[model samples]
Target: MNRVVVLTDSRYLGQRMPGALIEALRARDMPAVSARADRLVAEVRAEEGTAPEPVWGMRRALPALRPGDLVVPRTRNAFALSLLAQAQLRGVRTVNRWEAVQAVRDKPYAVLLLARAGVPTPRTFLADRPGALAGLPGAVWPLLLKPPYGDNGHGIVRVDSPRELERLPWSEGMVLAQQYVDVAGVDVKLYGAGERVWAVRRPSPLLAPAEEWPEPVPLPVTRELRTLALACRDVFGLDLYGVDVLPSPDGPLVVDVNDFPNYTGIAEAPDVVADLVESRLTEVVHP
Candidate 1:
């Protein structure tokens, strides 16, 4: 029987959606398991006219994964990406596909694709040095500086003025600078699970967390938001993803996108995601 393998950090498994999805899959009688991508010890061999094969683990190697199994990549560390790449090369199917995940995880590339595809997005700037951010066009003042790759609102800062931008500590590497929209402390998060797109209103990450932030309340998925969300997905051909939209005076603009996002605040997430997983497996097995 075909089984599902979720690539992620095992320690955080119980606290995240992948863990929940694993349980949900099992509950539905689908065989599932989680492999710690970060802990993986793999050796990949590449040669002419042959797909790469990865031998995993240090001591007791796990049984070789085959094309009949489905891989769901929930981790993005170098090791995880390498394993996923090898898996794809060997004909093992992955939800969202490793290529799509890699493209979308790269914030700069994803945003560029979105903008080029005519999707509304925040005005963006990229610079290798933080000090250079202060010299961007004056109109882009009050912008956000984000680490090239991160999740859960980590390492993001708002620069409201040139002086503030100038004071940013020097960090080595390319940085993403984005126009900060005033959303009145709220953001619309669009979660896509296959054919269903769910929306919720939650406190914006830019806002300081109050002693008690309001729980995210479900919102009707507007046609525009749905179309925009799917459009963003189409750019990367993502299967399971989330789109962050800011309701600004100009219009709702996509500020971020995440692959296999923790389905926070979405009540029906487990069942819906399980359905999507089963459908993908069906397509592969039948086709």
Candidate 2:
């Protein structure tokens, strides 16, 4: 592939993409170009000396890609990953294939996949209706509530009991609630790239307006972390993601599986992401 076109949000078009990627492309003497959504779509001002693609919506970007080109989409939006699905339909190989990315975006669907794969995730229920909770087991006062669509722990809540459920109003889409477990302060996030797993330990970010976030436990490399990371990829079919497993008194509890986990702030830097991209590219070439 002579040209590698990376598609991502307007924010990290260049920041999160490893300088190493440019360096890696250069080492191979391949021409690589980086552009954000607006630039790629001719919406925003593209960097000087860059040619912008047609200003088409997310899905249109897929068919626009030619063979042997690389596309890295970081948006969790289904339409965003649909670009890859379009590419796949046209026989274009892309990183983190479309079907894989989409399957894990919905939390309940992801849990179902994990269950099918024999991976033990946190107890979960898919709330198909507002009153679906009436049929759910474990009618305890305190349980975890999650919206079908959530970010940064935004819609995740801990309800003390059925009393709290009464005050809440019903909405159109589905919602889910889970039995809350006693988790230690730590949340372990394992990042998988191809065959390697880079484990990072983050303290629980579950904070309220009046509370402060706690300190994180530094990551200690372990076989268990690697296994779980691989399991996440295999179960959800997502090639790139952040696997969140909370440690409980019982054992490790898999809490969240993010399609596009917060990359820039947490993953350390251009080095880590660059390494992952390069390895993926290498797999593409060698395979």
> Candidate 2, 111: how far from true, in Å?
0.8
Residue 210's C-alpha lDDT in candidate 1?
27
Question: Would you estimate the TM-scores of all the predictions?
Answer: 0.90, 0.77
Top of the candidates by TM-score: 1
Off by over 4 Å in 1: 46-60, 208-214, 284-287
- On residues 63-93, what C-alpha lDDT tens digit does candidate 2 reach at each position? 3455556666666544445555655654555
- Candidate 2, superposed: residue stretches over 4 Å from native: 11-30, 38-64, 135-141, 170-172, 208-217, 260-276, 279-287
- Quote the lDDT for 211 in model 2: 28
TM-score, cand. 2 vs. native: 0.77
